[model samples]
Target: MDIFEDKVILVTGANRGIGRALVKALLNHGVRKIYATCRDLNTMPSLDDDRITVLSLDITNDEQITTVAVLAQDTEILINNAGVINAGNILEGDLEGMDNDMSVNYFGTIKMMRAFAPILKKNNPSKIINIVSIAAYSPLPSIAGYAASKAALFSATQSVRIELAKEGIAVYAINPGAIDTDMNKGSDWDMPDPESTAVKILEYVADGKFDIVPDEMGQGMYNAWREDPAKLSKIFSDLYYGEISE
Candidate 1:
């Protein structure tokens, strides 16, 4: 079945980056309506389509989430793609930076889930898709707080999946390696295109896959978990530190 055909969908952070791409892809898949929520709806690139409804939303704001949840009551798919990355190591960074990262990435996601879980439960066969990162599995020093937030989100995704399974709602966690987005504008590593990543994610979602690793790096990390966890962890540590250790 083409899950997106005639489906009503909601994608947070739909102004730019992966979220924007996902909104376009969902439209291409025959989605009947899409609520594209961002901090400022006017900033969203012009879609010039009647099916796309631009909404102003700040995921961290409970009132905004509640308002939108009621407005998008027919939504069958919720894409939690809004996130923030604070660049700093755990030791050197101020507590505020760490808290900001957690507030937006982890708590914000949880808040959205809490607000929409009931709506989703009422609309049976709905699904919730969370955009996590490979950093969740392998933390890096430079983005320790960002990684920690995502790690917490990954754990929450697992718990949500288990708890919601009985309610007939499927929860998915999509962990992607570096993707070419404003979030990593100055990074010096190869990153996949946001559009490509979005397309791949939608494909997996259509197949009802619960967990999606959207790139080679993501698959490698998952494979290493089974083959050699310690070695993989050291490899990631060395990559971030520039030297191998005993």
Candidate 2:
């Protein structure tokens, strides 16, 4: 339905990385207004566009989310792009880090979705795009906790998609592979730049794709997941344990 052009969109974690790239892409796509939010307004890059409004937001904070929902009542698209990855394994890692992963990545995103669902309904013909990860399909041993959180979000996306169907709020889950962002700075994966990844994401969103695997690596993982999840899991495990090399 050409959701981008002239649409009122709200993007979380817009200070940098994918969220920042998405804001730039949305500007190029001719969106009417964009509510770009991040945990710290000071860190937000200069986006000198009349159509954009910068706001402070930490998705984990209920009060901040409520304020944003109230302020951006006209939003037609809510992009849950805020997330964190603590470098830790499920078994020997700090339990607190795992908890933090679930808190912001899973719980935080869910809260934002719930808060904005009503606003989206009022706007009608709206969309909610959750920036999930291919890790949702198979656990990466290094950041197993983050992978688990994404997995939870992926499952929630499926459930909410069905729930929001009758209400005309199209819910989409974007499963991106490693992208060139600070979040993946420690990784050696040949990741695509965030700008290209963001462009691909919106293209799929406008195309009405429910579950979007946005990059080549993520697409391969998605294909393997569809074919056989257990096999994919083993491959990830082997890679982590140095049984295979990319």
Candidate 3:
């Protein structure tokens, strides 16, 4: 099914970064409506169109998640794109940083999925796309907390996918390697453009791909996992530690 054609989609964290690009791509695909939610709707780049609805939403807040879930019950596509990155190791990092990362990346995603599961069930032939990170598959030592949170989300996505399959609803996990966004401004590695990543992701979703790894790096990680899981972990660890032994 061409999921974006005349469908209603709700995208979280749509004010900027990849989320905003996703909204624009969906609009180009001729989606019927897009509820773009962010912490500050006013900051959202202007998309002068009647089809787009700007909403103020913080996914970490339970009340806000519930409210938006109710308001956008007719949605056929739910994109959980909201997340935060805490730059520190799990053991040595501030406890608050770990909590914040989990709150937005893992728990926030779970909360949103839980709140919208019923609506998705009611609206059959729906899809829920979770924007997980490459960190989910391979953890980095520096960003252990962030990676752990995404790993949790990745596991949750699998469980939900199996449980929702019978209801004709598909759950997708989108793992894109280092996209050029504000989230990774300080990183030295080359990253793809957010707009391009958004386009590829939407295309994959429309084609009903379950695990959409959009970039070459992501594909390489998947290949490594299939060939040797331990080797892949070592490669990631080496890269994180600047070992230059890939």
Candidate 4:
């Protein structure tokens, strides 16, 4: 069965980057409807399809998340794709930026999941896709706080997967290495195309993979970590800008 062929999907951060790509992918798959959300509705580009509904949602805000849950009652797939990136070391980062990373990347997703889990359960055989990152497995001290937030999300994803499986809600966590987006500029590693990454994501979702290493780099990172995590951690911490990263 094609999981997305007739489903109602609600995507957070649908305005740009991977979220926008996913919207287009769903359209191509002939989904019934898509409730596309961004913090500011004005930022979302208009789509010509009648099946698309735009909504204003800041996942960190309780009222907004509740309103979305009420409004999008028929949603079958919840894509927790919205996130924030904070720059600085964990020891002495800007408090607001660090807080924002956790709030948006970790807590914000928690809010969305809490509000929508029941709706998805009611919809039975539904799915929840959380867009985590390769950073979830390791640390980049340059953006230490952001990595920590994703790491927290990764843990939550695992627990959600096991708990929700009894109810037929398949939870998917995507860990993509470096995607070419405004959020991922100036990276030391090769950044894969966002559209390609998005396509790979949906393919994995259809294939029913719970934890996905979405791109080649991500797969390599996963394999390397599995082989010897200590070696990879030291590589990231000591020589992130050296030959191995490239």
> Would you estimate the TM-scores of all the predictions?
0.95, 0.96, 0.94, 0.95
Best-to-worst lDDT order: 2, 4, 1, 3
Q: All candidates' lDDT scores?
A: 0.89, 0.92, 0.88, 0.89
- 1-246 in candidate 3: lDDT tens per residue? 355789999999998889999988888887899999998767888989899988888989999988898789898889999999987876787778889999999999999999998998898788899999888887887788898999999999999999999997899999888888999897777788889999899888768788889988778887787798887798787787783343
* Candidate 4 TM-score, C-alpha based: 0.95
Which scores better on lDDT, 2 or 4?
Answer: 2
Error in Å for residue 55 of model 4: 0.3
Summed over model 3, clashes come to 0
lDDT for model 4: 0.89
Name the runs in model 1 displaced over 4 angstroms.
243-246
lDDT of 4 by residue, 77-193 (tens): 999999989888777778889899999999999899999999999998899999999889887777888999999999999999998989989999999887888797776657788
The number of the candidate with the highest TM-score is 2
Runs of candidate 4 with Cα error greater than 4 angstroms are 239-246
Give one digit per residue, the lDDT tens place, for model 2 in 79-154: 9999999877877988899999999999999999999999999998999999999999899888889999999999
Best by lDDT: 2
Candidate 1, residues 1-246, lDDT tens digits: the string is 388889888999999999999998888888899999999867899998899988899999989988999899888889999998887877887678899999989999999999889988988789999999988887877788999999999999999999999998999999998899999898777888899899999888878788898877678877786587775687677777773241
Q: Return the number of clashes found in candidate 2.
A: 0
lDDT of 2 at 121: 96
Q: Which residue pairs show collisions in model 3?
A: none
Where does candidate 1 clash, by residue pair? none
